[model samples]
Structure formats: structure tokens, C-alpha cells
Target: PLAEKHGVTIETSGDVAVSVGSHALLLQMTMNLVHNAIVHNLPERGAVWVTTGVRSRVVVLAVENTGQKLPPQMAATLVEPFQRGTGRTHTDQAGVGLGLAIVKSIAEAHDGTLTLTPRDGGGLRVAVQLPAAPPDTGR
Candidate 1:
């Protein structure tokens, strides 16, 4: 809904189905990032891009969006519980800021890592990297 409303273009690639600790947790993480990409984007001309790939023994899931730049200090604390970006705390789009926090928690629980990088142009890029599981063998 947000994507359609903002006309955000979503481009995806790579093998989406990969062995992970928990599918449900991953779904939640990806959904939150994607939602944030749309909600926190520019009012117009917003864009989102999602991709997945395997790097070494890790599975990478990344979401990138176009929006206003976030300060380094704010971005650093974004994964903290209840920490939200400026001007986003009192608007209709206001969030409790638990989204990224929860994402980070879940990643850590699975022995993975989550990173948020400010984009070169504007907006942010979030990536969650988890250890890839060995292929299932016939039991």
C-alpha cells in the first residue's frame, strides 16, 4: 500500500529461498524494513530496492530507500529501542522506533548481524546478514 501510494519502485534479485534459523523472524525483519523504506521516504519520487544474495557463508538481505538524509548520530542509535528519527516522532507516520530495534534483536538471536548505512544520495540502506545453513540432506 505505501509503495503504491508513493510510487516506489521495488527491484529484487537473487535466490530468495535460503536456509535460515527461522523463516517467521526473517519475514518480520524484511517486512519492517520494506515498510520503513516507504513510510520514511520522500513525499514524492520515493524509491525502494530489495535484493538478496549469498556472500561467503552468509545470506544477505538488503533494502534501500530514497528519502531525507539521517544524521550519523541518529543513524547510529536507530537500532536502540524507542529511538526514532527527528520530525518523524510526532507525525501521522510516527513510530515507536521499535522496528529496527526488533530487527537487530532478532538478527542477533540468530547469530546474524544488521547494519544501517546512509545512502550516498539520500535515504538509507539496511542489510541483514545471517549465516547460511547447510543444505538439507535426506534424513
Candidate 2:
């Protein structure tokens, strides 16, 4: 597993029972989260926690990692197309900053929502929530 190769532990919990969108989009969104977790972490070695479950009428998928805390202003801009934060001093992890924006776009296309929160202690947490699939009528 790439997580193991990178020394990033994964903690997954709960069942994600909804199938509300294209599999491609789901994979893309998840990969984006994983990539961001690995790339943007503090590089001091940390774990990535992925949790999925139904909360109320929404299906929630969360990705969390330990890393340098992002500035509140920059966190607000994270979903803007091609907008890289001026606070990032790491040149090696360079990115156009479109990843989260793309994720947001895909989520919106699926009638879902994306959010980012500052993790307590340290790091960042990214969450995506989608409407639950309609009940199967077996028609």
C-alpha cells in the first residue's frame, strides 16, 4: 500500500453504504484527499485517518492528517482554482493548488459538499458529504 510505503498509517472506520455517484468521481475525490494528506503533511511522519459513515441524511467521508497548521485566511482560499498559499515555504512540494478546487468541483457536480477544518493539536481535516442514495425499490 502507498500508505505503508510512505510510512503513513491509515485508520478507517464505519461503513459507507451509499452509491450516489460515478465510481470515477469517488475515486478521484478519495485520491485527492490521500495525495494532499501525504504531500502537505509536516514531514515528521504521521498517520492519515479516513472515516466514512452515514450522518443524518448525508454520507460523510473524512480524511485527516497531522501537519503544520494552515493559516485561516489561506485555508479559506484552498478551494480556489490555481490559488497557492503565499505562506507555504516548501518548494519541493510545489503544486498549482487546483487539487482541492477540483475536488470541490466534483463534489458539487454530485450535489455534495466539501469542507476543511483545522485539526486540534495540529494538521488539517478535509471532509466531503454527499446526499444519501435513494432507497432501492427493486424496480
TM-score for all models, in order of appearance: 0.90, 0.86
Give the lowest summed-lDDT range of ten residues in model 2: 84-93
User: Cα-based RMSD of the predictions, in order?
Assistant: 1.7, 2.2
Write candidate 1's Cα lDDT for 76-112 as tens digits: 8888887676544556674777889899988898899
Candidate 1's C-alpha runs over 4 A off are: none
Clashing pairs in 2: none
Please name the candidate that would achieve the greatest lDDT relative to the true structure.
1
State each model's CA lDDT, in order: 0.83, 0.79
After superposition, the stretches of candidate 2 with alpha carbons farther than 4 Å from their true spots are: 84-90
As for model 2, its CA RMSD to the true structure in angstroms is 2.2
